[model samples]
Each structure stands twice: as C-alpha cells, then as structure tokens.
Target chain A: MLIDTLITGLVAGGTYALVAMGLTIQFGISRIMNLAHGDTIIAACFASFVLFSVFGLSPILALMIVVPVGYVLSDAVYRIIMRPLVARAPNAGALEVDSILVTFGLLFVIQGVLLVAFGGNYTGYAFLNTPVDLFGTIVAANRLLALLLALVFGITLIFVLSRTRWGMTLRAVSIAPENAPLVGIDINRAARTAFALGGALAATAGVVVSMYQTFTATIGVIFTMKALIVVILGGKGSLTGALIGGLLLGLVETFVAAYIDPGLTLAATYAIFLLLLILRPTGFFGQAG
Target chain B: MNTTVAFILAAAALAGLAIAPLFLNAYGIGLLVGMTGYVVLASAWAMFSGPTRYVSLATVAFFGIGAYTVAVLSETLPYPLVLLCACAIGLTVALIVGLSTLRLAGIYFVIFTFGLAELIRQLVTWYEVNVTGTLGRYIFLPFEGIHIYWQLLALAAATLLLSWWINRSRLGLALRAVGDDEVVAAHAGINVSRAKLMLFALSATIITLVGAIQAPRWVYVEPAIVFNPTISFLTLIMALLGGATRLWGPALGAIPLFLLFEWLSANFPNYFSIILGVFFIGIVFFLPQGVLAKIEGLRRPARKAPPENKERSGAA
Candidate 1:
C-alpha cells in the first residue's frame, strides 16, 4: 500500500510540476500571471480527446500537433490581448495587475468555448489501462507512461535552460530585463518566446493529464489554483522550485491522506504553503522582485 | 456632486426603495434583493480596493464566516445579536489577515489572500467532513421576502454613506497616496499599512454582515455554497466595471449589470458567461477609468470653463 501510494503521489506530482513549469516560465519572463494557463491545458485536453476519438490518433502523435498550435495561439494572444496592456502599463506592478485581469477574462472565454463545443460533462478515454509492476508495486500503464513523458519533457527543458545559449537569453531576460537589452538581447522577442514556451508546456501537461484522468470543461480553474500554489511554494520564476515544490506537495498530500484523515490533505498542503510564504516572502527559491 | 444635492438624491432613492415593496410583486422584490446584493458587495469592495489598489479575492471567506456563524448561532442568540457577532468575527479575521498580508506587496499580496481564502475553505470542508459527518447546516430566520429586501437596502445605504464619509476624510487622501506610490506615501509620513488595514477591516466587516443577512435567504449554509469562488470574481468585476476608484461607481456599474444578467440568465443561459467575459475585457480596454468618467466626459462641453486663476490654484 505504501509503495503504491508513493508511486501514485510521484505520478500526480510529476503532472503538477509539468503544469506549474508552464505558469512559472510565463510569469518569470513575460511577468504575466496567466490565469488562463489551465484553460490552455484544457483546450489541449479536448484536442487530444478529439484526435483519439475522431481521428483514432494516439496522444503521442497528438502532441506534435497540439503543442505547436498552443505555441502559435499563445503568441497571437500576447500580441492581440496583452500587447496593448503591456504598452500602456507604467511599470511591472501595473502589468501584473492588467495581465491578471485580462487572463482572468480569457479564462472565462475559453471555458465558454469549451462548454459550447463539448458540453459540461466529464470526458475521458481508455489508454494503456494494463497494470505494470514497478519496484514490486502495481501501477497502471497509462500512469507510468504519463510520468515518463513528463520526465522526458521536464529534463529536456532543464538541460536546454541550463546549457544552451537560447536558454541563457531567457534566463538573462528573466533575471534582468533592463540589462538584457543593454547586453544586446531583444527583450520583446525574448519575452514573446518565453510566453510561447510556457504555452507548449501547457499542451504537454494537458496531453499527459488526459491519459489517466476524467475532466470537465469548467474544471480548469482548479488546475490554475494548484499551479499557482506550486509556483508560489517553489518560488515564482524558478522552474527547479516548481518541480521540487510540486513533488513535495504531492507526497505530503498522499502521506497525510494515508496516515492522517483523508480530508486533511488539502489543509496540510496550504498550511505548509502559507508557512513557507510567511518565512520566505519570495518563495523557497524565489528571486528578489 | 455637492453635499446638499447628493443628500437629496440619496434620500429620494431611499424613499423609493422604502415604498418599492408595496408596488412590486414578491418575484420583483426577489429581483431587487439580487440587485441590492451586488451593489452592496461591489461598493464595499470599492471602499478598500479602490483607494489601496489591493485586489483582495477573499470576500467569500468572511462572507462564509458570517454565514457559518449565523448557522451555528441562530438557534441560541437573538437575530440582531447574531448579526453583530458576525460583524465582530469578520472584523477580527480581517485584522488578523490584513496584519499579516498587508506587509506583502504586488502579486504576492494577491496570491497570499487567494491562498488564505482557499485554505480557510478547505479547512472548513475538512472539519465538516470529519466532525459533523455532513457538509451543510440549515439556517432559520423570521425574515422573509420583503424583509430581506429592506435589510439589504439598509445595508447598501450604510455602505454608500460610509464610503462617502471616508472618501472626504484625511484617511482617504492617505489611501490614494498609498495606491499611487507606497514608498512615497511612507516617506511622506503617512501610516500606509495601518490606513490600509483599517479600511480592509471595515469593508470586511460589512461584507461579513452581508453574508449573515444573506444566509437566512439561502436557508441552508455550506462551505461550497457560502465560500464559493465565483462570488469573489463577480464582486471584483462589478466594482471594476463601474470604476472602483470613485464613490457610487460600483452602484452605477451594478444596476445595469444586474438587469442585463437577469435577462441573459433567463433567456440565453449558455451565452451568459461568454458575454460576462467580454464585459470584463471590454472594461479594461475601453473604460479603465470606469463608466462614471466616460459619462462625465460626454457633458464636458455643457459646463463653463473655470476662471484662469483656477488653473493656477490646481482646481478643475
């Protein structure tokens, strides 16, 4: 039971980390707290569902199509919806407020579209339902595959971020936007790229989630809240923090539900989030604003 | 508006509300309750968020607290005392929350309050599950349709009156300064943090009472229903729509919105949310200063130009 719970927790946490990475990157670079990040994921989920049910395409193949579309759509969103706000904002603080409000509206729009298209019903499809053995514990094949895909995407992201020049440009833009331009980097292009990258991650997370979970059109806000928690817990603008924080949240929730009351898991998660925030205002590994 | 004219307008509105029950049917009075609810909430929200520029999403937290307080105490205490206790409890919670959270600035403050609200909600749910074995409590009160409308009307009047008084006071000046620049406000010798906390607590107290007044209407109270996240979003949007920065702005926004929503919800329920979303985005892009400013601008040509000396004195 314990081993099964551990694996389950890791699987859930891995998916959460995948989601939070998308939000952290957007917030870290473009500095827009995209409240609609979850809507992007939901849209991707519906996309994958359609590919599988209608076109008989596997999720892995759907990834190639959905991810690029997410990137392109997000880039367009930044241009059409966010550009005016960004142009008018007097400072980072104002941009954050404007972005939050705009994205909050975007969230409703996306949900409305999904509702009109799909109706408000829980939808999922069977994928790799066979049980597999991992460290002598039985787990669903779909869950294992989802975790594997998340790790591949997550590791590749970390490697590219740490070892590549493109990654260096993003980090520079994130850490010092004013200095990045002085160093000859185009801040607008880099921010646009970062926002797009976050969208790609949202698609990736959505594909992974649709594999093993049932979801409704209006449930996107739950994912946003959880991602927000992980982002704040891990520290904003810190991918590594999101990864570790997501994992910790999953494990804490699982362990608490197992040993303590089942209902206390949520309370435990936020209690720790609050305490950590009180102690480290910027988050556990968050940079100074 | 001048003090005399504003007073007359306010009194006339109150008188209309007082006599409205006689002419309106029960169904119409119910609709009025909905309108009053939003106006009170949006106005109360503007009282603090307008001046301080702190976008607090915790309205439902104190609202739920007030409701839960009444649900637990309505059987033991008098209705009036129960309402007072709800206010006291809401004020205490707001002070505690403001003291801890007001120190954080920008997005951190927004997220902290959001997290705290969710935390409170989840905790209440957990308690209900583990201790009570149920998720809801039935509330009983002597107040019915018209009585509920009257109480809500009184609440709205008190909210507008208090907002007007504070906007004219020295604290209002200090608050606007804090909104524009916290550092400048602090350096200029205003107790920025305390001023924010006071208003935050005050608005929270009113919101709590609103929840209490509303609880009997629900007849049943639960964390899911009372602590709904939608209420937070709806309140924020209404205030922003009318312009949170000005007195009477929320009411201006709330009245037309309430009417429109009533029509849309009844006719095209599926498209209601989509239109609401468009409304939010529209307000930000087109009317950032709010409808009041837009309306005020239309009559600009009718007013005579101020004397040349007025410009030198910084009067418009």
Candidate 2:
C-alpha cells in the first residue's frame, strides 16, 4: 500500500516538477517570472486534444508536434515582445511591473482565445488508460512514464545548469545582464533560448497532465497557481528544490484529500506556502542575499 | 465647504439615476451599476497607488474580504451594518498585511501582494465550500424604500469625497513624498511607515464600501466573483488609464472602459477578452505613465514644467 501511494505521489510530483522546472529556469536564468507559462501549457493541451480527439492521432505523437509548436510561439513572444522590453531598460536590475503586466495580459488573451475556439469542455484521451499492475495496485502507464521522464529531466536540467558553458553564461546574465553584454554574451540570444526551453518543458508537462486528468481552458488558472506555489516553495532558481517541493506538495495534498475534506486541500497547501514564506523566504536551496 | 454646489450636483445625479430605470433597459441599468462599482473600487485603488507608488496588486484581497464580510453579515445584520462590518474587516486586514509586506520595494512587493491575494482567494473558496456549501449567500432587494441603486450611488459619492479629501490632506503630501523618494522622505523626518499604513487603511475602507454595495446588487456573493483575478487587474487598468496620481482619474478611466467591456462582451462574447487583453498590454508597454498623463500633457502643453524644476521651486 505504501509503495503504491509513494509511486502515485512521485508521478504526480514529477509532472509538477516539470512545470516548476519551466518556471524556475526562466526565473533563474532571466528573472522574467513568465506568468503566462501555464497559459501556454493550457493552449498546447487544447491543441493536442484536437489532434487526438478530432483527428484520431495518438496522444504521444500529438505531444511530439505540440511541444515544438509551443516552443516556437514562446520564442516569437520573447523576440517580438520581451526582447524590446529588455532593450528599453538595458541597465535595470529586474524586469519592471509593466513587463509582468504585459505577460499576464498575454495569459488572458491566450486563455480567451482557447475558450472561444474550443468552448469550455474537458478533453481527455482513452488510450492513456493503459495501466501497469504492481503487486495489487494498478498505476497508469503514462503516469509512471511521466514520472520517470520527470526524474531524468530534473537531473539533466541540474547537470546542464551547473556544468555547461551556456549555463555559466546564463548565470552571469542573471547576475548582471549589463556586465554580461560587456563580456561578449548575447543577452537577447540567451533569454530567447531560456524562454524556448521553458516553453517546451511546460508543453511536455501539459501533454502528460492531460493524459492523467481531463482539462478545459479554465484549468489554466488553477494550474498556474499550483506551478507558482511549487516554484516559490522550492526556492527561486533551484532545480532540485523544485522537485523536492513538488513531491512534498503532491504528497501533502494527496494525503489531505484522502484524510480530511477535499475542500480543505487548497487552503492547506496555501497555508504551507505562507508558513514557508514567513520562515524561509529564500526557499530551501535558495541563497540568502 | 461649497455645500450648495455639492448638494446640487448630488441631487442632479441622483435624480438622473432614479429616473434611469424609467428610460433605460435592464441591461443598461445593470451595466451602469457595474461601472459604478468599478469606479469606486478603481479610484480607491488609485488613492494608494498614486500617492505611494506601490501599484498594490493586493487590492482585490481587501475587496474580497469586504465582499465576503458583507455577504456573510447581510444574512444576520442590516445592510448598513454589513457595510460597517466589511469596512472594519477590510481595514484590519489591510493594516496587518501592509505592515508585514510594505517594506519590500518594487517587484517584490508586487509578488508579495499577488501571493497574498491568491492566498485569500483560496481561503475564501475553502470557507465557501465548508461553511456556506458552495452556492453562498444572496442579498435580497429593497426591503424598504431604499434600493440597491441608491445604495450603490451613495457608496460612489462617499468614495469620491474620501478620495478628494485625501488629495488635499497632509497624509496626501506625505504619501506623495513617499512615492517620489522613500529615502528622501525618511531623511526629511517624515513618518513614512505611518503615512503608508494610513493610505493602505483608507484605500481598504473605500474599496470595502464598494464591495459592500456590490454584494446586494448581485443578490449573491460567491468566492469566484468576489475574489476574481480579472477584477483586480481591471481595477488596476482603470486606475492607470485614468491617472493613478489624480483624483477622479479612475472614475474617468473606468466608466468608459466598463462601457466598452459591456459592449464587447455582449456582442463578440468570445473574442472580447482577447481584444481587451491585447489593448491593455499595448497600453502598458507604450504608455507606462498611462493615457491620463498624455492627456495632461496635451491639455497644458506649455504649463508642463519638468518635474525637477517643479521640485526645486517647491523646495525654495
């Protein structure tokens, strides 16, 4: 029983970790806090739903197409919108509230567009119901696969961030963008790459998530809040922290629903976040300023 | 006090509103009420943002608190008493939250406020599910001669007057000082903390009153509408569009946009949100200072002295 629960918890945690990693990467590398990241995920989910539900394609193949499309859309947003913003305020320590607002506005625009196009209906795939029997328990194959992928992605992300030359340049740009330009690193190029990678991660998670639970356009708000809580709880710019926080949160929420009233789960999760903020604002692995 | 001018204008506006039911359709009246609520909420939001330069994204939290307070209390208490309860709750929450988070500067404050609002919203949803069983409380219309329309009008008037009074008060000067330069304000021996707390409380009170009026109009108060993220963003847009620093700016900004929203949502329905979001984003990127600033510049092109020059003259 415990193993089943742990496996279920880890799989759930993995999907959250994927979303959290997307958020943490942008936050760690560019400090943009891409509030619209989850919206992109929701949009991609709808796009994938169309491919599977309407066109009769396999969900896995649909994801292969949607992930790249998501990356391209995000890259366009970064170049046309965010790049100009950075150029306008080249010496700033952080992006302005206006930048946040613009991204947030984009979130609404994307959600509204999806809502109009698809109507508000929960979409899910049937083939994803393939389950793997472990002892007496049955776990969905996709959930297990997603969990394994998340672990592999998490370790790979940490390795890339900590080891690579591009990673070193990203850290420098984050620490000091103006000085980074002086050192011959192209700030715009780095930001675009970070946003594209972030977008792909979000879309991948979205595809996996839809396989587990049905989704609608309105799902974006709740998903965005969850991803944000995981990112914040894990600590800013810490990939390992994202995984740990996501796992802890997934367990807590799953247990909270199982034991206590399901209605209290959101409040409980939020309370934990508030406690974390009061106790350790920097998060578990985040450096103290 | 210019009581005569105030009374005459009040009487004219009230007379127009009272007769609105006679001339306009239910849709128009509904849209008007919504616009009025946004006006009060938006202007109250501006009171603090203009003076303190904080651009408080947490105004919705207080607004939600006030709304829920009214919704819960209206079940037991009179409507007027519900307003008082909401005001008190709003002020208390704002004071505690402001003191704890106000010290953070710039983007951190915005993030904190955003988190705070979301927390409160989640709490509200939990409370609604557990205590009220999802549907939540509804306000009954006009038990006596008093109607929702009149009550909403009164709240709007009170909000406008409060905003106007603050604009002329010493706290307003302190708030403006804090916005211009917090370090300088502290160096000048201004009670920066006290000034901000006061503005926070005042803004909460006004927005709470707006929420109080809003509860009865919908005849139902649910967590979703009370603590909606879009409503918070809309209020910010209204305040920015009109002019955050100026009195009546939010009203000027919100009234027209609210109408536009009503028109678009009614006609296009699905595409309205995309259009609104794009428009808001374009405005923010291109006009960071807002449309009101451009209008001010256009209205008094020659009268526009540089901010530094004005400061130097004022200092001398």
Candidate 3:
C-alpha cells in the first residue's frame, strides 16, 4: 500500500512540477505571474477532449496538435497585449500586476468561451482499463507513462534553461534587465519566448491531465490556484524549486490523506504552503535576494 | 448636522429597501438581498485591493468565516450579537494574518493571503465533513424574506460610512502611499507595515459583517458558497468597474452591474456567466479606469473651460 501510494504521489507531483515549470520560467524571466496560465491549460484540456470525442483520435496524438496551438496562441497574446506593456519602462511591481490583470482578463474570456463551446461537463480518456501489477501492488500503465512524459519534459526544460545561450540570456535578463540590454540582449523577445514556452507547458499539462482524470471548464480557477501554490513553494523563479515543491506537496498531501481524512487534503496542502511561506519566504532551493 | 444628514440618508435607503419587497416579486427581493451582500463584500474587498493594489482572491475566506460564524453563533446568541461576533472573529483572524504577512510586498502578499484563504476553506470543509455532517452548514433564522432587508440595508450603510471614513482618514492616506510606493511611504514617516496590517484587519472585519448578514439571509452556509470566488471576482469587477482608488466605486460598480446581471440571468439563463465573463474581460482590458469614469466624463464633458485658478488647484 505504501509503495503504491508513494508511486502515485510521485507521479502526481511530477505532473504538478511539469505545470509549475512553465509558471517558474515566466515568473523568473519576465517577472510576470500569469494567472491565466491555468485557463489556457483548461482550454487545452477541452481542445484535447474535443479532438477525442469528435474525431476519435488517441490522447497522445491529440496532445501533439494541442501543444503547438497553445504555444502559438500564447505567443500571439504576448505579442498583441503583453508585449506593449513589457516594452514600457515602469516599476517592476506595477508591470507584474499589469500582467496579472491581463492574464486574469484572459482567464475570464477563456472560461466563458469554453463554457459556451462545451457545456460544463467532465471530460476524460479511457485508454488504460486494466491495471498493471508492479511488484505486489497494481498501478495504471497510463500513470507511469504520464510520469515518464513529465520527467522527459522536465529534463528538457532544465536543459534549455541551463545549457542554451538563450536560456543564459533569459537568466541574465531576469537578474538584471538594465544590464542585459547593455550586454546586447533583446529583453522583449526573450520575455515573449518565455511566455510561449510557458503556454506550451500549460497545454502539455492539460493534455496529460485529461488523460489522467475527468475535468470541466470550471477547473481553471482551482488549477490556477494550485499552480500558484506550487510556483511559490518551488521558489518563484527556480525550475528546480518547482520540481522539489511539487513533489513535496504531492507526497505531503497523499500522506496526509492516507493518515487523516481525504476530505481535508486541500486543508493540509494549504497548511504546508503557509508554513513554508512563514518559514522560508524565498522557498527551499531558491536563491537569496 | 452632518451626522444627522448621513443618518437620515441611511434611514431613507433602508426605508426604500423595506418597501422594495412590497412591490417586487420574491425572486427580485432575493436578487436585491444577494446584491446588497455582494456590495458589502466588494467594498470590504476594496479596503485591501484599492490601497495595496494587491488583488487578493481571499474575499471568500472571511466571507466563509462570517457565514460560518453566523451559522455557529446564531445557534447560541441573537442575530445581532452573532453578527458582531462574526465581525470580531473576522477582524481577529485578519489581524493575525496581516501581522504575519504585512512585511511581504507585491506578489508575496498576494500569495500569502491566497494561501491563507485556501487554508480557511479547507478547515471549513473539514468541519462540515466531520462535525456538521456535510461539506456545508445551513443557518436558520426566525424572521424570513423582506424582514431581513432592513438588516442588510443597515449593513450596507455601515459599510458605506466605513469606506467614507477610511477614505478621509490619515490611515487611508498612508495606505494609498503604501500602494503607490512602499519605500517612499516608509521613508516619508508612515509605518507602512502597520498601515497595511490595520487595513487588512479592517477589510476582513467589514467582509465578515457582510458574511454575518448573508448567512441569515441565505438561510444556508456552505464551504462552496461562502468560499465561492464569486465574492472576490464581483468585488474585483466592481472595484475596477468604478475605479479602485475611490470611496464610492465599489457600490457604484456592484449595484448597477448586479442589476444588469439580474437582467441577463433572467433573460439568457444558460449563457449568463459566459456573457458576464466576456463583458468583464472587455471592460478590464479597454477601460482600466472603469465605466463610472467614462460615464462621469460624458455627463460633465467640461461644460465650460475651468477657470485658470481652478485648473491649477485641481492640478495641484
């Protein structure tokens, strides 16, 4: 039971980390905490669902189409709306809050549009009907595959952030944009790229989530909140932080539920989040300000 | 005399509310009461968002607290005392929370408050599950229907007065400074942290008072309903719709928008949320200054060029 639970927790945490990675990069590079991130995820989820229910395509194949569309949509949003704001010279907090407003406005639109397009019904995939026995306990094959996909994406994200020149430039901009421009970095373009990358991650998470559980249009708000918690817990700007935080949260929530009541799972998760904020405001692996 | 005028105005509003039930149908009365609660909640929402510029999604927390306080308190005490207790409970919790997080700035504050709200929701849900036998609690009040209108009206009036006082007070000035520039506000001799903490507590108190009234009015209290983000969303819409940094913006925004919502919901039914959501987004992006400012501009379109002295003073 413990092994099964631990594996399940890890898988869940891995998926969360995948979602948090997008948030981490956007916040770190652009200093924009995009609240509409989850709405886009919800949009992607519905997109996958529509592809599945209408065209009878497999979830994996649907993801390929949804991911690119998500990236393009987010890139367009950044170019059309957020780019103008980021181009301006203003207080960091003001700019960040504007991002929140812009993203929140987008959230409202996406949610409304989705509800209009598809009734508020839960959508899910039924690919893995049989559970595979791992050692002594039974686990779903899809869960394992989802975790593998998440791990692959997470590793790729880390590689991009750490190894690429563009990634280094993003870090430079995040650390000091004033200096980045002096060093010949196009801060606007970098920020826009980060936004697109984050959008792709959101869509990827959405598609994976649709594969795992049933979801509806209203899930956007809750998902956004959950992702925010993960972002904060993971150390606002650190992908490593997001991974650790997500895993910790997943394990903690699962253990808490296992020991206590399942109904209070959210409460326990929130409590730990509060504790983390009070104790280490910057987060576990976060660099010091 | 000023106090008397304020009192008379409040009384007149209450009187109008009392008669609203006689003319309107039950559904209309229900909608009015819900909107009143929302206005109160939204104004309380402004106490933090307006001055701090931190759009907290935690209005639901104190709202649930207020709702549950009423549910739990009305079992033992009178409705008025329960209402008072609810506000006190809300105030105390807000104070503790504010003190803990007031030192954090910008997004940190937002996260802290948001986390705290989610925590409260969890506790409420846990309580409902273990103790209350469900995920929600229902409040039963002796007097039903329009009889509660006076109470709601009184609550709204008190909220209006509180907002007015806050706007005119030194604390309000300090909060505004904090919102605009914390470093400058601190350097300029305002105890920025204390000011934020006070405002947080004050905002929670106002929201809780509204929750107290709402609990009895709805005759039901649930984790979902009380912790509903609708309170925060509507408050945000209202504050933004009326311009945040003003006294009467929330009321101006909430009252009319809610009326509009009533109209839409009555007519469209199914597509109500979709339409409302779209409209909200459109307004936010296009008119960050809010609909009220646009209306005000149109109504008074600088009829005559202001005197040079008046213009200078206004600029100053």
Candidate 4:
C-alpha cells in the first residue's frame, strides 16, 4: 500500500513540477502571470483528444503538432495582446495588474472556444492502461509515460537554463532586466520567447495529463490555481525548488487522502499554503531583499 | 447647492427603483434583481479594490460564507438577526485574511484571493459531508423575489452612497495615497494596513449581506452553487469595465454588461462565454480604464489627462 501510494504521488508530482516550472519560467522573464495558462492546457487536451479519437494517432505523436501550435499561438497572443500592456505599464506592479486583467479576458476566450467546440463534458481517451512493474510496484503504463515525459521536459529545461549561453542570458533578463539591456541584450525578445516556451511547456503537461486523467472545459481555473500555488511554494525563478515543492505537495496530498479523509486533500493544501505564506513569504528558494 | 442637487437626484433614482416592481412583470423584476445584486457586488468590490489596487478574488468565498451562515441560521433565527450574524462573520474572516495576506505583492495577493474560494468550498464540502451528513441545504425563506429586489436595491444605494462618501473623506485620501504608493503612504503617517483592513472588512460585510439576501433565490444552498468562483470574475470584470477608480463605475459597467449577458445567454447559450470573452478582450484593449473613464475623458477633452494616469503614480 505504501509503495502504491508513493508511486501515485510521484507520478502526480512529476506533472505538477512541470506545470509549476512553466509558470515560473514565464513569470521569471515576462512578469505576466498568464491566467489563461490552464486553458492552453485544456486546448491541448482537446486537440490531443481529437488526434486520438479521429486520426487514431498516439498522444505521443500528437505532442509534435500541439506543442508547436501552442508556442506559435502564445507568441501571437504576446505580440498582439500583451506587448502593448508591457509597453504601457509604468511599473512592474501596474504591468502585473494589466496582465491579470487581460489574461483573465484571454482565459474566458479560450474557455468559451473549448465550451462551444465541445460542450461542457468530461473528456478522456485511453492510450496505454496496461500495468507496468517499477521496483516490484504495479503502476499503469500511461502514468509512467506521463512521469517519464515530465522528467525529460523538466530536465531538458534545467539543462538549457543552466548550461547554454542563451539560457543564461534569459536568466539574466529574469534576474535583472534593467541590467540586461545595459549589457546590450534584447530583453523584449527574450521575454517573448520565454513566454512562448512557457506555453509550450503547458502544452506538454496537458498532453501528459490527458493520457491518464479525464478533463473538462471548466477545470482549467483549478489547474491554474494549483500551478500558481506550486509556483509560490517553490519560489520565484527557481526550477529546482518547484520540483521539490511539487513532489512534496503531491506526497502531502496523497498521504492526507490515504490516512485521513479523502476529502481533506484540498484542506491540507490550503493549510500548508497559508502556513508557508505566513512563515516564509518569499518562499523556500527565494532571497530576502 | 451642488450637493443638494446631487442628493435629490440620487434620492429620486432610488425612489424610482424602489417602486419598480409594482410596474414591471416577473421577468423584469427578476432581471432587475440580478442587475441590482451585481451592482451592489461590483460597487462593494470596487470600494476596496478600486483605490487599493488589490484585485481580490475572495468575493465568492465571503459571499458563500454569508450564504451558508444564513442557510444554517434562517431556520432558527429571524431574518435581520441572520443577516447581522452573516455580516459579522464575514467581517471577522476578512479582517483576519486581510491582516495576514494583504501585505504581499499585488500578484501574490491576486493568486491568494483567486484560490480562496476553492479552498473555502473544499472546507465547506468536507464539513457538510462529515459534520452535517449533507452536501446541500434548502433555503426556504418567507421572502419573495420582489423582496430580494428591494433589499438589493437598498444595498446598492447604500454601496454607492458609502463609496461616494469615502471618495470625499480623509480615509479615502489615505486609501488613494496607499493605492498610489504604500511606502509613501506609510511615510506620510497613514496606517496603510489599517485603512486596507477597514475597507476590506467593510466591503466583505456588504458582500456577505448580498449572499444572505440572495439566499432565497437559490432555494437550495450548496457549496458548489453558492461558491461559484465565476462570481469573483464577473464582479471584477464589471467593476473594471466601469472603472473602479471612480464612484458608480462598477454599476455603470454592471448594468449594461448584465443586460448584454442576459441577452447573450438567452440568444446563444452555447456561444455566451465566447462572446463574453471577446467583449472582455475588447474592453481591455480599448477601454482599459472603463466606460466611465472614456466618457469622462471625452466629456472633458481639454483636461489634458489620460484616464490611466493614476497607474503611473509611483511607478517611476
């Protein structure tokens, strides 16, 4: 039972870690909290659903199509909707407000499209439900696939972010945008690329998530909140922290549901979130100014 | 002389709305009731969020709490007492939450408030299942739809009046200063937290009362029904569309948008959210400051001030 629960928790945590990393990357450079991020996930889920149900393509194959679309669409969104707000916003706080409001509108647009295209229905498609053994523990193959994909995406991001010169420049932009321009780096282009990359990560998570779990049109906001919570828990601009925090959150939730009451999962999440805010407002990997 | 004219005009408008149910059919009354509810909700939300610039998504949480309070108590207590308890409970919760979380940056607070409804809904669901052995409550009050309308109308008037009064008071000045810059407000000897807490609690109380008043409309009280997270979004949009920075801005946004939504829902139910989304993006792109701001700007073109100048304060 312990092994089963731990495996389940880790699988869940892997997806969460990827989702949080996407948000942190976008927020790190772009400074725009994309409220519609989960909608992008939902859109990809629907797209993947269509690919499987109609074209009879595997979700793994669907990723190739959906991810690039996600990147391009998000880039278009930034160019059309967000660029003006970024330019007009006099300060970071004002930009935050404008982004929240605008993305809020964007959230509804995406949700509305999903709702109209596919009525408010719970959607799912089974890909690989066969059992797999990992360390003598039984787990579904789809879930394992999800875990592996999340790890690959997350690790690749960390590598690129840490090792490459371009990634370092992006990090520098996130860390000190004012200084980046002084160093002759084009901060605007870097921020846009980061935002689009974040959207692509969301698309990746969406495909991975839909492989195992059922989803609905209205469930996007809940995912947004969950990702936002993980981002706050992990700390700003810290991928590794998001990884640890996401896994911890998943374990905590699973344990609470298993030992205590299943209904207490959300309550436990809130309790820990509130406690963390009160105790360490900057988060685990955050620096105090 | 200006005050008297303004007061008389407001009074006449209130009187007109108060007697509206007598002339209108059930449909009109129902429409007005919803519009009035949003008016109060958006206005009350604007009272704190407008000047403070803290866009709170906890509106549904407090509103749901007030609804639950009434749902549990309306059977045992009188209507007025039930309302009072709901208000008191909402105020307490708001004070505690505001004290703890309002100090965070704008984005953090927005996310915190965004998650608050879901958290409260989960807790409520747990309590209902474990403690009460039920997930829903039936609120059968001795109140008519017209009664709900009148009460909401009175509340809307009160919200507007209070907002107007605050706009002229020292607290309003302090709140504006805080909204402009928290550090400067603190340096200027304004107790920033106190001002924010007071308004937060006050607005929360009104929102609670709205939930209490509208309980009969639902008839069945459940965490899912009462704690609809969309309420927060709707209220925020209405307030922003109207421009929270000004008195009556939310109402101006709420009235037209509410009517438009009603029409859209009726005409193209499936396309309702889609059209609404398009409308929201249009507003953010064009009338970012709100309809009132656009109107006021056009009305006084020689003022040489853009509507969003307030956002520029302390940004440098």
Better of 1 and 4 by DockQ: 4
- Across B65-102, the per-residue lDDT of candidate 4 in tens digits comes to 88998888888998899999999999888877887777
**Model 1 C-alpha lDDT per residue in residues A1-289, reported as the tens digit of each score:** 8998898888888988999999999999998889899989999999999999999989989999999999999999888888877777667767777788788888888998899899999999998899998889889999989988887888889789989999999999999987999989998888888899999999999999999998899878868878888998888899998988888887888888888877787778767766865688788888766
Query: How well is each residue in B43-112 modelled by candidate 3, as lDDT tens digits?
Result: 7787777877876667878887888888777878987788888888898888867766677656776766
Each predicted complex: what DockQ? 0.38, 0.31, 0.35, 0.62
What lDDT tens digits, residue by residue, belong to model 4 across residues A1-289?
8988898888888888888888889888899888898888888899999999999999999999999998998888889988988888777878887788888888888998999889898999999999999888889999989988988999999999999999999999999989999988998999899999999999998999999999999888878887888888889778887877888888888888988989888778878888987999788987663
Q: Please, what are the lDDT tens digits per residue for candidate 2 over residues A1-289? A: 6667777777878888888888887776766767687888787777777787789887679778988887897788888888766665433332544466677778888888988888888777766578799777888887777777778877887788779998888878767776898989997788888888888888888877776777888677666667777877887778888989888888777777667766767777777876765677777887764
State the displacement of the C-alpha of residue B174, model 3, in Å, after optimal TM-score superposition: 1.2
Candidate rank order under DockQ: 4, 1, 3, 2
The ten-residue window of minimal lDDT in model 1 chain B covers: B307-316
In model 1, the runs with Cα more than 4 Å from the true position are B115-118, B301-316
lDDT for position B183 in model 4: 89
lDDT of 1 by residue, B1-316 (tens): 5989989988998999888888988889888888898899999999998877777878888888888889988999999999999999899989877876787775766766665566777888888787878888888788887887889999999999999999989999988888878888889999988998899999999999888888888898888788887677778888988888888899988888888888988998898778778888888777766788667766685786443211111100
C-alpha lDDT of candidate 1 relative to the true structure: 0.85
C-alpha lDDT values of all predictions: 0.85, 0.75, 0.77, 0.87
Per-residue lDDT tens digits for candidate 2, residues B254-280, read 988888887897899889778978977
Please provide TM-scores, in order, for all candidate models, with all chains considered together.
0.94, 0.88, 0.91, 0.97
Q: Which runs in model 3 stand beyond 4 Å of their true positions?
A: A87-89, B1-28, B115-118, B134-136, B292-316
Candidates arranged by lDDT, highest first: 4, 1, 3, 2
